[model samples]
Target chain A: MNPNVPDDSAAASRYAIEAVAEITHVSRRLIVVYCQHGLISPVATPEESGWLFDEEAIHRLRHIEHLRTEYGMNMAGVRMMLEMLGELEQLREEVRFRRGG
Target chain B: MPAAFKDYYTTLGLSKSATEVEIKKSFRKLARKYHPDVAKDKKTAEEKFKEINEANEVLSDPVKRKKYDELGANWQDGGGYRPPPGGRAGAGHRADGTPAQEFHFEGTGFSDFFEQFFGGAGRRNYGFPSGEQEFTADGGAGRARRGADIEGDILVTLEEAMLGTMRPISMQTADPRSGKAETHSFTVRIPAGATDGRRIRVPGKGAEGTGGGVAGDLYLRVRLAAHPDFRPRGADLYYDLDLAPWEAVLGEQVIVPGLSGAIKVRIPPGTASGQQLRVRAQGLPIGKSGDRGDLYVVSNIQIPTEMTDAERELWEKLKVASSFDPRSDSKT
Candidate 1:
């Protein structure tokens, strides 16, 4: 579990790759592909047994899926879009901060 | 529900005679302007983008354009136009005469107006998942379909964001079969370190799946409420630290409001107006790392506007004694 997250039982739950696939509607193969592509960084289990994902990972997978399926974007395009969106979000936050919001 | 007539051309700021190229050009320009991702005013931009996309969807397509043109002046006559029975708009029904399988646009950002007219056609052409599998009446095997995800905004205060909080949310969606609106309520646990635009997903809380498919998830996009006393920058909080001239010259310890409570911050000696003081680890929580960002207190040196005669005399004496020239370096 990520130490930064509160110790509440609900937020503390971590999922293996398979459970992540099940909940996120992503196939196990695609999950591995995402991991390999460095789109996501799931924690490695003890002795590298498997990967563990937190809730944030699940949210990211869903976002990736939305971009892929709805926008008809390839992984490279999705990656680029995500990067741009991140930058855009950062810029927006900066604007908000400057505006004293 | 009564269908409201929408004038696609007007919505796109185009005329009925606009060329295909003109339509595309106008759409791209308007889309870029109003796209929620880039727009400065996100809420308004989102609504505008949805409207622009809906208009473009119809006008950009030759078939839909032709059908819309058929409506002609009636399209603008609110309640004057009733689509003829068995018209192309109603062509989504299967030949077997069962009402067309319902598709929800919960997370799609399309409106009921778009769904009423072009939803089925758009789905068939766009190949968006219908969220439910179609099966024969006899219970034969069918493809498993995923449910449609729902997206909405949730407002959180700065204090609530510092420490995790639970929010009760309620949403109303129309039942596909009966067309009756249904309300569903659930509590969402917002994690600490949540920031503006952060999305939290609640599994199986979205539109119900058809044919025994699983329900979709609900995604709540976080929007921070405006704070009166502080401004948040990423993980840090910024607050104005007012100081008297004497305090600015002579360092003083003062208490200020923090995310949790009052915190004593030191105003270093010789601090100037607009200078910032950082209090380490006094900011909002970062992701579950047990680490925190620092808080920045911006100094605002306040001068007395109305002074007593004695105070004015003292100020005059100080002004005469002090040789500091703020404008000495100015070229003008």
Candidate 2:
């Protein structure tokens, strides 16, 4: 689950990946890959079989889509780029900590 | 149409059973090349893009591609494209040529070559395992239903509208089964020339089809909020060109704000109130040419509500010397 998305208290507000795929044009495989690759995680934990996704996943999937269609980057490429960007920020943070700024 | 095997492998520039990495890389390469912005030539780019998307649709899915590959030799020499006994000349018409049903691409152009080769029987009876049984009617009343179109709006500031900015708009969509309102957000790329009344259509983002029909679209109507200083017409912007009485008569180059940044407005000598000065190509964007409308500066002469003694003396002297008269031919 993304920390940025506020939690919905409504019991019926939740959904699974299969349902999310219908809303967004993202395939189930790609949605799974996003979770595995840490692009986006589900807001809720699954009780029995499949994982449950929330509205936040839909929002994040749209971001991933822009990177694909508009930017023309594939899922794997998007994952790698996002990882590198996160690393760069961490490195910047370390430097700042060292300088005590 | 014949059951010609559309080689998904060759379509993505891959062998029959290429690795996942190879397929993804190939798709990325093709997508960049055929992207609408990069490919300015619309007709060619659109054809290539559709081909790529069609290829990806099949190739990206393991099950579909596997099923397609299983029919191997059957598809090699156009095997599965057999028409049901008799051929219908026009699309969706019966073998008796009685016009069974009409097909619509809805004015959006598709490649004629593609339509010629793949448009016939292959598309009509694609009995995918998931939804095949739903439309198993022999001939009548079992057609798949298309989804309803969805509508949405995006709110932007006047400045954002003038220069154009991409904004992420959030929406609440109902879950099909649960009937829950799920919040979703997508960033829309706003064109530079977009105005308050302008609308953008994003295909395939609207409602899902009921049966197996094509999905509807999402229409984003742009709404621009008011600005403190600036107002816009179609492409041009309006601002009050406030000038001192002396500056209005003598004319001066005054700094003013434009869409990009500040610009100097050159007021000509002897300019009067309500006089409009045009600065070419300084307003909002005109279509794809990257040109814009002219900025119009309407002059307003300001009078001193309070004056210093020296200012009053100067005004008196000017009034005595000047031949210009107020109410000269008046009956007041």
Candidate 3:
């Protein structure tokens, strides 16, 4: 209930790359490729493990795969679209914040 | 939350150390003065009324008040809040902080600060108006009405969003007639391509409806986890590409790291600080589309705070030979 107290959710659930692949139905190779393109990132450190993904990364991976397969969009094009979408989301958020929402 | 902070105490006309009674008294006075229904300038009065309500809403509640006091005192110390070392950037969205009770609501008129900080907390004090009930007693069959809609945050991973998933939500409400608590669970379907702030609605899954009426829908707002390395501004991902003086002026191939391998990007000669080196198709995917965004490498030219003897000697030699004067453009 105390906001000053550090929340427990800070140590959130993180899945390894393999588990994320299983969850998202995205192949490990494609996931790694996405990582190479900087499309998605793993939260794990080198000393810790190969790759660890949180929920956000997993969602992004699925979204990436969906675009690749469903829309037939390449990585570069996908990146542009994503950027524009992200910008739109940001503006919406800003308006909400300004309005005290 | 926005960078601009609101002083709730000032809005409520109170000192930092005001008491609960004084807060209530002030809120009552302000409410009477600014009540939109009675005011000449209704539009302005409405804004004033909402402001005072938010002020009172936080100051009156103990938990919210404690959090505000901490932030208020911390802000007075003069610094933007930077999380302490190894704190995981502690994204305290409090997503799972969904109250187990059936106090669902919507359009409560909260500011960004209130929603960001004490958002996950229950707003039970905003008692339901009897007028909101859809039915009235007709001296016949019992009146029935739909329950208030529920709103709570759901922490969604990108993986789940892309694949579509069912998340379980449970609510316990006191049975009005029996006066006993009853718990019920429902699945909230998060569709594929669901993005942050998108609400996943579970039809007829909110608080129990009165007299066998249909239940209201439960709305779970999606919130994504924060990334440590890259920050997303729309689809474009931004990374601070740190560079040394020589690298900035002379240009060099710098190694930018990723999860699996490092990307060697060619930094052009005479590259200025803050210049963006964009890598195409190196960001996130668009909504249900094949379009991806670009990754922007924002150059940050850093000078070594401490230098070794040989490094200092080399810098001194370069300084003697160099024609560059950083302050040349300055008019002052």
Candidate 4:
């Protein structure tokens, strides 16, 4: 697959870079980076030109905002911090993943 | 007037013996914390602010407080208010010429009674010549007292603050000139780079004076709305700009977001997450001088989550090609 080609799954979802940027105050590039770094995962498929962001993505962004603004964490520190947070999330998710709920 | 309130003593948590300076110091500290605009609880904060203002009003002036303290507590719970003698003064006269001075009811303001008894500098309606003489001698005559400064709050985003903005604020005032309450609307111009606690004064926007006095000034205390990306400390602004893993490894021109818009910033090769770069004079502007604070950009590197077959092959080739260990201290 060509890396530059747009994904098809995104066509079904509604959020775009501009929409999330308008709401989150974070840039499109940063949101993409957050997705790339596993701090947040894109819930929608890349069927179209833009990816759709869900409420969970927005919640994650708010958590990131609290870290940067209140705790004064840089993105690198945020990355490391997310790793620990991910561990806790995974532990909780294991029970749900097992129950298929 | 049954009795007057002990607001001054209550304000300082002190007795009447508390010195004037002590009362002032206590007021300043309490005002900073509970001044409705700063307090967290809106309703209670406002009430506390008014209470503090009332307390300060009495404590700041000797005569008002003295008259206030002289009246006993019976004036507050709704019992001892008797209007002054004479058909016009509301004074209760028991067929005696002398002023019947004992108050009999409650719930009137201690400040109100002081102003009534002392005549508050000028109100020529009453026939008491003695009240007039005392009012005139006590720095009350020929004094052009400035109107009490009024405060308000305005919340705006960092973007609005950066370019400067003008917002219309609504306020109500009892105009002394007209003797009627009027709602006034006016646009308040916010200076670029204004900080919280920075007061903007609008002329003739405050409470008007009595006896043809000049109107007071309105003061606006600014509050910065929360932003998702940018953080401001003092005059400088900070932002975290994200980069692809390749962009961090190889130098690139990345788009950096700002309060107003986006700008291109060059990232040096081998840039790491959390590395900060400075953009000078892009933050808040200095007051009146037109100079600005710096904007600090911190780099964030993002790694790709999944790889295609060909991408996986390339990554496998690169993984063996480089010996860089991300975690050097790992015991495993």
Candidate 5:
């Protein structure tokens, strides 16, 4: 797990796809499928060989696995859930921003 | 986790023999009924809608449907589902009543069942068996794999965050292997000068090992709760210090509420409204450097809306005596 460096979040350490595959216990092929579905994005998508993933994407992948394996949701179902959850999160953020400190 | 057997077939008004197309059709029909936009009773409809959606989620997928069917083998004869005689227990205990012995972890947002049976690509198109599973081709045990890490969120008040505190947090998830919900509780010590959004790692407190392998770690993410007196920007604190118009113009010594305690700050003479007064090192701790970021006292000046006779006379005297015209400086 990576530490939360809010200032240098962009410069945070990244992991290769193979490392991510090992961490999530998911196949590289399935992770590519998830990318095709736009479920999660990579920190860097380089030419030919390697793609890098950060902590956020990894947590998201684990959540995806949790949704599928634990909650019994298919890709379509998981996609819908993610969309709804994302929208809900966005709404909450908007409310919090508007609320102000 | 489904504590009681929910009859998805009955919910959809379809039998076990219902085809895929029929399941879709029934789902669409009921979904329309409790669609939230069209439902008559909004409250009950919302709950009913969730039930309908859950039922559809299970029945629509072929693999999930198969698993659900297997779990509910005697759905027709069942009032409550007893754990299949010795099915899941086989993972932890063998046929000879010997403990097969695997690992367990108290994860943040997943069921223990998933961590046990389906975790790490048990039944997916993801290559094959698992990335970390220690099993041989002939169904024999192999090398042990380290347990997966667990992540969780914990709310920290700026007060507690600055001084550093240890908090006890407990995570509860359903354990399908034992057919019970398990709760694992532990205390996490947050170091002083902990930054917001930073993760505090508690070593080896994550999910248990798989096959006598080393256990994983638990990472607790700090979510700083909103404070009433101050707004933290990194280690710096922002305080809205309200002042009267006279106080803004003449300046005043005021008490600024610090994270640790009340701090006194002097508002410089001729301080204008919206001017920021900096109190150095009065904010929260910055990292582990033992230094604190500054506390900014933002001036919010207020003028009297309703004036008494005495105050109105004083204002009238000042208005005529003062030659200060702010509009002379600009063309707007």
Candidate 6:
């Protein structure tokens, strides 16, 4: 739970696509689709066999699932919305930086 | 249990006769404005968004709208309305004849009022089967099933977010046998650099699994509480630095409040109001990066509310001597 507390790089958990799908409740096909569409990238470079995802990828996939199932958005719309949300977050950071928050 | 009457039209700022298009328009506007993802005040925005969604759910559907209007009309006449036996509320079936079922919103927040009135219908519309198997394993019929995952919001302060902290959380889970709620309390360790909307998972701490199955995980959704001196956006922080006009013009080293403590910041000469100064690596920590974002200090030039005679004389002399005109280029 405290990934940074021990400062052990090897202690951080990494998941394959199957494990990511299980944890996030998203299908493997959809996860592959997301990666193919450049929505999310693997934490480490893919070997000849498989790709490994970090915890951030799991969170992002969960968010995408929420947008799709709960909000009833299409994949294209979800992708656009996620990009916009990222931009909006960066813009908010800039605004807060300017305000000296 | 009966729910209090809800005025959906008033919730959406619409009239009784509002059309479907009008309802859609209002719902979209409110949804975008208060979506928890984009809102600065997340807690309030989340509440508002739930209320708006519930309002939209009833108003946007023609059959539900008709029944709601009838109920509203009756309530208007009686000054208080109770559902008639075997009527809309008593007959637990939707307008489409689907049997009423308990709907669980999970992390998607809903209200008791919504549960009472339109919960079953919403489940049908959303295609969520009531009492659906949450996490099923492919074991034999007698095998235990994993417990359902539980989610709740936890409020954290700016300082606690920067440094790792522990929080006590009280959770209520329904007893499977008796159908009664049982409350349990425990402490959770939140890691440093936890940001707003971040989800922290505690393994095997959720509801007890049936038949000796493993317990589900508890997910705590982090919400950062408002700080008096700091405004946080992502990992960056902002603070307002107030200076007198003379100080702003003359430029001097000043003490400004920071998340940790007061830090000395140099104000360059001829500093203008609304100017921002950056202090790199002084903001909140990012997730496990071990590197901090920058802090921004905005300058606010202040004039004296009231001046002593001596100060007024000095100001008058300076005013006469100074040739600066802020409005010099403005056309009348």
**Candidate with maximal lDDT:** 1
* Span of ten consecutive residues with least summed lDDT in model 3 chain B: B123-132
Backbone collisions counted per model: 4, 4, 23, 30, 2, 6
Docking class of 3: incorrect
Q: Residue by residue across A5-87, what tens digits does model 1's lDDT show?
A: 23233343578888988887689889989888978778655357668887667777877887787667899998898789779
Best by TM-score: 1
Q: What is the Å distance of residue B256 in model 1 from its true position?
A: 1.0
- Models 1 onward score TM values of 0.62, 0.42, 0.47, 0.39, 0.48, 0.59
Task: Tell me which of candidates 2 and 6 scores higher on TM-score.
Answer: 6
Arranged by lDDT, best first: 1, 6, 5, 3, 4, 2
**What DockQ do you compute for every candidate structure?**
0.16, 0.01, 0.02, 0.01, 0.04, 0.14
Fnat of each candidate: 0.09, 0.00, 0.00, 0.00, 0.01, 0.06
Candidate 5, superposed: residue stretches over 4 Å from native? A1-99, B1-148, B207-216, B329-332
In the range B79-127, model 2's lDDT, one tens digit per residue, is 3543334443323333344432222221122222223333311222111
DockQ top scorer: 1
Model 6 chain B TM at 0.55
Residues A4-66, model 6: lDDT tens digits: 232222123578888877766678887888999878888777775478986557656756765
User: How many residue pairs of model 4 clash at the backbone?
Assistant: 30
Candidate 1 lDDT, B129-207, residue by residue in tens: 4222343553324545556565555556666778878765555566536778765555667789887777676666665
CA lDDT, candidate 2, residue A28: 91
DockQ metric, candidate 2: 0.01
lDDT of 3 by residue, B1-332 (tens): 12245789999889988987788678778876776545799879767876786676578766778977776654533444444454321222122332223332222334545554555522221111231233334411365644444455665544454455555444555543355766555445555556666545444445555566556445556654223245455555667788998899899998875322467788999999989999886665655466666777879899999989999999899999989788988956
Q: Quote the lDDT for B24 in model 3.
A: 69
Cα deviation of A1, candidate 5, in Å: 22
